[model samples]
Target: MYMLRKFRKVFSLIILTTMMSLGITAPGYAAMLGTDDILAGDNLQQQRDYVKELLNRDEVQNQLADMGVDPLEAEQRVDAMTEQEIQTLSSQLEELPAGASALGLLAFVLVVLLITDLLNLTNVYNI
Candidate 1:
């Protein structure tokens, strides 16, 4: 009877520890960014920069001051944009550019190589 009581005590302690751990971690988990953070962050830098660039143009500086974006923060965010992101800004302003179809291009090239091999078109084709 004593052994059984001891076993039950240990099991209860384990379950209690797990529950405590979860409760302690719950607030940290809640602070995490979700899907909305991801989508919003995607354009965060661009929006910041657009505000600055437009601010630098005629009369927009006063507009930005009215909007409460600190001039330094706006400048910093603009400078922080990566080169690829800057390129995206230009591309986004225009219609999407034409591009090769990845799967189609891969298939087309593979077929052409196979046909060339079957025809023994190159000295490198052994059989």
Candidate 2:
């Protein structure tokens, strides 16, 4: 019984030493989120969803196809956009006139995609 206790103590000591030496510990960080920060995250997601929904529309998809831009590839490009880019696009979308034609919206999207392609941020378009 004494030998068993000694072995357990020694084994535990070895394990603790090994763990400490190897630095096998997970680091954590915590911060209190402000209302604006939390709301901004939600708003960003909503903006992304709104853009995706617009892209998924049959008219938009058809326009993209006609322009030789794959709708799926365009969606992927939007996903890769930075927060600033999304915010800019979303703001522009909000600024559109209430009577704006679908063609105007489609043209705006195509222009954005073309700029991204030129910047080499996306490979959706051959040009």
Candidate 3:
């Protein structure tokens, strides 16, 4: 009978300690279960936010710098781009001709020169 009383005391202490350690707040804890489910809303902002997130990636920014694209200007362009444009940007990044990333800036400059050459807007190397 003495052991039974001690066992009850221990069990009561364990329940008390468990409740205290769980930090049960006095208000509205049970009310949360009664709340209605949330409904979905318009998603345009989500699309814009997702595009903005893509522009923040390391590889896209790195590739921009490699291709002589100014960091700020590229950022501006990205910001100005439509969601459709941003959608295409990731694939376009991969299609950049392979080369040294930093030197890619110089390569971009070279590409511009070639464009002018083809257009006959500039002389070849001798000029």
Best prediction by lDDT? 2
* Cα-based lDDT at residue 13, candidate 2: 100
> Once superposed on the true structure, which residue ranges of model 1 sit more than 4 Å away at CA?
1-54, 92-127
Prediction 2 global C-alpha lDDT: 0.84
Q: For each candidate, C-alpha RMSD in Å?
A: 20.3, 4.2, 16.0
Q: TM-score per candidate, in order? A: 0.28, 0.76, 0.31
Cα TM-score of candidate 1: 0.28
- Rank candidates, TM-score, best first: 2, 3, 1
lDDT tens digits, residues 1-127, model 2?
9999999999999999998989876789999999999999999999998888877888878988898888888888789888998998878877888756356668877888789879887666677
Pull out the clashing pairs in model 2. none
- The clash count for each model shown is 0, 0, 2
Candidate lDDT values, in order: 0.50, 0.84, 0.53
Higher-TM-score candidate of 1 and 2: 2
Give, for candidate 3, the lowest lDDT window spanning 10 residues: 33-42
